[model samples]
Target: MDTAILPLGTVIRRQADSDEQAIRLWLHGKSAHSQRAYTSDIERLRSFVVRPLPQITLDDLQGFADSLADLAPASQKRTLAAAKSLITFSFKIGYSTFNVGAALTVRKPKNTLAERILSHEDITRIIEREDNPRNHAILRALYETGCRVSELCGLKWRDVQPRDGGLAQVTIFGKGGKTRHVLVSQRLHEELCRLRGSSGTDAPVFPSKSGRALDQPAVFRVIQGAAKGAGIEQRVSPHWFRHAAASHALDNGAPISLVKEQLGHSSLEVTSVYVHARPTDGLFKFLNR
Candidate 1:
């Protein structure tokens, strides 16, 4: 494989790079959660098929999809989707001769991923009950910025820039490698700043207890522990904070457009869930009064 110069003198291996190398390089640019999920899915496919790309046919793909019948429908759908994506990616950058993934379709099941909505009081209790500074900062950043687990984990000290008025610009790399900035409130900024002060600008904003970058599982565990301590009965997931952020923001009268942009949602349709997701005090007060 040979190297090619990207814009600004960045170097990357050319299209002729090995299939495994090419896949790994592409995965590196994805958000951490996606990277982990896709890697595991693709590895499963490799183990199941164990054949050369060009020799693999649509029937082979069908058998793989059929094999996942015992799994949840959503898991089956996502695994098939990831397999398709791998084939598509392989063909796109010369890893394969054609995009066979186009034909490997699995019927998506109705989404049963339960959405856990956290109330403002629940959030307060969770925060107060969190014992450590690092986890406290994680919870706060997750709620305040409405960032995904991947985006929050991807943050670096250099990505945060302090402005004149005690606010901070937090740079986030969202899905599809899209970049966006969110301004942190003074209270949130202080929490981040305290951590930032201890680490180099290039280091992770929230490193793991092992002194390396924090993984998604670590963040999830922290949230779960905090929730248990706060006496929340519902199983709390990391994405719940993001949902709560959008819901609470809308409930408190923030514009949908602004919340949409803040959450890095591609369309209003995705962001619109928060509109009706929150509980309202009175729906017909104006109608009656």
Candidate 2:
């Protein structure tokens, strides 16, 4: 991958015969987002292990997993997964005789649907409070499309098709090089068009002043500030928009299957997290009616 285009903080440190070099080889085809995550996880394992790669044993890996204090369950899982991948690859490539990372097991974390998601009113208030057109558009895109921060940042004007009826479709390139389409609301379509004003199709839809994709941290800071500006007290991450999007769509009667496609999830079960937040089918109300 071109280092120039690599997302911020995803630099591939490939000194010859080093662990970093090995990681670069293993993550060769992964997206920048994936690379950054795995890199952090792998580097964390390095800090935990005192011995060399070949000297590390299964016990060390398990101990590391057990020692993940103060880490979120999702974070714990990814860190272990990364450690396992590194061990497996190191064994494959003769870095070690044993795949120690294989022996480590990660406990699946309970999904907290309510905490990670936003209410429709919350998202609306955040966007409405934002005074900047570009920043407001960014917040709206995250909510409307359920797109990852990287996907939203990577959006280009050419990837959007404005229909005669005013609605627009966006071709989003997601994790693992997969592509999916998201329908933009008429209001959002107009906002995007107004923000895009006369820019060439090749230009980024939300370019930084340097004429490149907006960095993820900047997007995060903007969203966090917007949430505060709108008087939201709960800690909000950019991904909250995506969770909220899935939940809100289903709440509005969008089918589960359609929600799955909108989210580019591989299975309905992955999309089913949104179902946890839905109101009961109103059994009492139905009887009363």
Candidate 3:
């Protein structure tokens, strides 16, 4: 740690003095997913700006943004945002005298939520096509819970408990260390119980053949293979199930607030994207053919 004295007799506490140290301090409390994404984004910035944190100028930031022209808008935005976060943190920690990231404008990215959503029939087909019990449960729980794939992968047997009327409640550890309870149907509950067998409470709800907790990539392959087997030509990922769950629930008249809590959304506006993406009714409905 270091300290700096200003002309006005003000002293600033410095937690980090270099770019690498600043990045580490910035990512200290972030989730694993965020840490990985932000690290990759910072790496992209390093590739463009070959200078120290304090030496980076607005011109360097702008040039880095320009070099991202080859990437998609979303990627560009995310990378720039990560750089901004890092540079901002560096300024806060007295590593840099100026917050150059503040001057760097991040362009808005395209919204492809609608294109990623799958229909009810497609979701059902993919689930039915999976013959493996573990993979089948994974697909069902993903759609049924509307949980992130990371949350599902980290599920533990102790997190699931039998509920009233043969239903079951699952406690999902979501983003930012938030936990939410989701109720599954009786059939799903039974399926999970059967899958649990004699495993201990600390055991993962979904385990690989080696008896370890299933990883995200393996679950992705499970869903992709199932989708292809069901004749879905387009690329399918575990996230599509989450999107489909939100859209389908909203389409069937489920309240947006309920969906928000179930999905662990931080805001109603985040949950409202599904309604906006797939509006069931509009002025076109009243048009006479």
Highest lDDT, which number?
Answer: 3
**10 residues in a row with least lDDT, candidate 2:** 1-10
Q: Which structure is stronger by TM-score: 2 or 3?
A: 3
* Per-residue lDDT of model 3, residues 1-289, tens digit only: 5775444676678878577788889999888888999999988888888889778999999999999999988899999988998888787777777777888888788898899999999999999888988888999999999999899989999999999999999999889889999998898888899899999999999998899999888988998999999999989999999999999999999999999999999999999999999987799879997
Candidates 1 and 2 compared by TM-score, better number: 2
RMSD after CA superposition, every candidate: 6.5, 7.6, 2.1
| Model 3 C-alpha RMSD to native | 2.1
Clashing pairs in 2: none
Give per-residue CA lDDT, model 1, range 161-190, as digits (tens): 988789888999888777888988888789
| Number of colliding residue pairs in each model | 0, 0, 0
Of candidate 1, the 10-residue stretch with the lowest lDDT total is 4-13
Compute the lDDT of residue 234 as modeled in candidate 2: 83
Model 2 alpha-carbon miss at residue 59, Å? 0.7
The models' CA-based lDDT, in order, is: 0.81, 0.83, 0.90
On TM-score, the candidate that comes out on top is 3
lDDT of 2 by residue, 46-162 (tens): 899887776788888888888886799989988888888877776666555556676677788876777777778889999999999999999989998999999988999999998
Clashing residue pairs in candidate 3 are: none
